[model samples]
Target: MKALKKIATSLIILALAAVPAFAGQQGESSGILTWLFLGFIGLIVVGQLIPALVMGFGMVKGVLGHSDDHSHKHNA
Candidate 1:
């Protein structure tokens, strides 16, 4: 049952991913709506990219042993 559920979820994700491939292909109008659609798509792309970029930067920092806090203790 779990395997079947996983397969169904994967198929649903794949179907949703393929939607953009068929979008705007048969459309005849190229007006404000087109620009709006494109802007929305761009926003979605950038929204995903920002978190990915942050995570990537954090990973790189970890691999390079970079940290903001100093480990030394100064006693007065």
Candidate 2:
């Protein structure tokens, strides 16, 4: 009985691990949940990107020491 159990377990594992080997393209289109999930992920990416771009530009400004506000003080 132990040997039979071991064989059954091993067969199940083998079948599971090789599932992608037989997986093919789905014939149906994706559902709304899939599009919603993709949109949520997109929003997350864009939300993080905006702040990163702003910070990057700030860093560039600091490194270059370029400021336009100094013109008013220079005029004085």
Candidate 3:
């Protein structure tokens, strides 16, 4: 099952990467709408990256066994 998942993921990534190559040549100037569409896509990408970065930091912190000072304080 894991192997199948990896193969499927690889194929999907390859398909996405090939898109730009299949695109028509941009010979004319792009208007505001084109810029807005690109900007929206950029924002979506950054939104995804933020969560991924947070998860990655958490994984690293877990592996290092780091804890906050508050967790160590106890009340009698």
Candidate 4:
């Protein structure tokens, strides 16, 4: 009985691990969740990636220096 229980447990683990190996073998589309996840990742890439790249380039170019753009006014 103990050996049978150990074999059953090992079979269950093996089956769980093998699940992804046979994934998409059936002719079925990946459905809406995949597209929705991709869309979410796309939005994040657009919102964060572009600005980060631009800011990095600007930093390398020294475009963030605080220059005196306003004239100083003297008051008594």
Candidate 5:
């Protein structure tokens, strides 16, 4: 009947769609040296970031203090 035709067509489509999944090959992993190099790079980045943040915060504090120093107009 008409319903049977539609069911057969859907099953054919589903089977074709699943072919790629069955064809996939497993990948090999990079080993420990890759991890060690990545860790070393991460450390270098973090080390640079800490001093940059401290200097940024110090600049912000200095700017805010300059604004507060406005009350010392009489000192001029």
Candidate 6:
């Protein structure tokens, strides 16, 4: 029973060791996925930042009364 346990443990260790080797074989799909993940993150970051920047600029412009043209345009 002890010998059987030792063999089983050794097999388990070998299997675990092979996990990295299997991961290494995941190739181009993994690289593509990583780049896609980064791009998604960048898009989200930019999406959040751009709106905030625009809102800030709009607030500053509004407070400064920079867009007070309330006159209706005459249609030709």
Best by lDDT: 1
Give a tens-digit lDDT track for model 6, residues 1-76.
Answer: 5986899899999999988887666445557888999999999999999899789878977898866677989889
Q: Which ten contiguous residues of candidate 2 have the minimum total lDDT?
A: 67-76
- What lDDT is obtained when candidate 1 is compared to the true structure? 0.89
Q: Looking at model 4, which ten-residue stretch has the lowest summed lDDT?
A: 60-69
What tens-digit string does per-residue lDDT give for candidate 5 at 1-76?
5986899899999999999996776787769999999999999999999999799879988877745445555655
lDDT of 4 at 1: 53
Taking all chains together, each candidate's TM-score versus the true structure is: 0.48, 0.51, 0.50, 0.42, 0.52, 0.43
Q: What CA root-mean-square deviation does each model show from the true structure?
A: 9.1, 17.7, 7.4, 17.3, 19.1, 20.7
For model 4, the local distance difference test gives 0.86
RMSD of 2: 17.7
In model 6, where do residues sit more than 4 Å from their true spots?
Answer: 1-30, 66-76
Clashes of each: 0, 0, 0, 0, 0, 0
Candidate 2 residue pairs in clash (backbone atoms < 3 Å): none
lDDT of 2 at 50: 90
Residues 4-70 of candidate 2: C-alpha lDDT, one tens digit per residue: 6899899999999999975776677889999999999999999999999799978988989965675
At residue 23, what lDDT does model 3 achieve?
82
Report every candidate's CA lDDT. 0.89, 0.87, 0.89, 0.86, 0.86, 0.85
- State the lDDT of candidate 4 residue by residue for 1-76, as single tens digits: 5986899899999999999988858786888999999999999889997899788878966776777667878798
Model 3, 12-52: lDDT tens per residue?
Answer: 99999999995877677889999999999999999999999
lDDT of 3 at 67: 66
Model 4 CA deviation exceeding 4 Å by range: 1-27, 63-76
Clashing pairs in 3: none
Error of 1 at 50 (Å): 0.4
lDDT of 3 at 74: 75
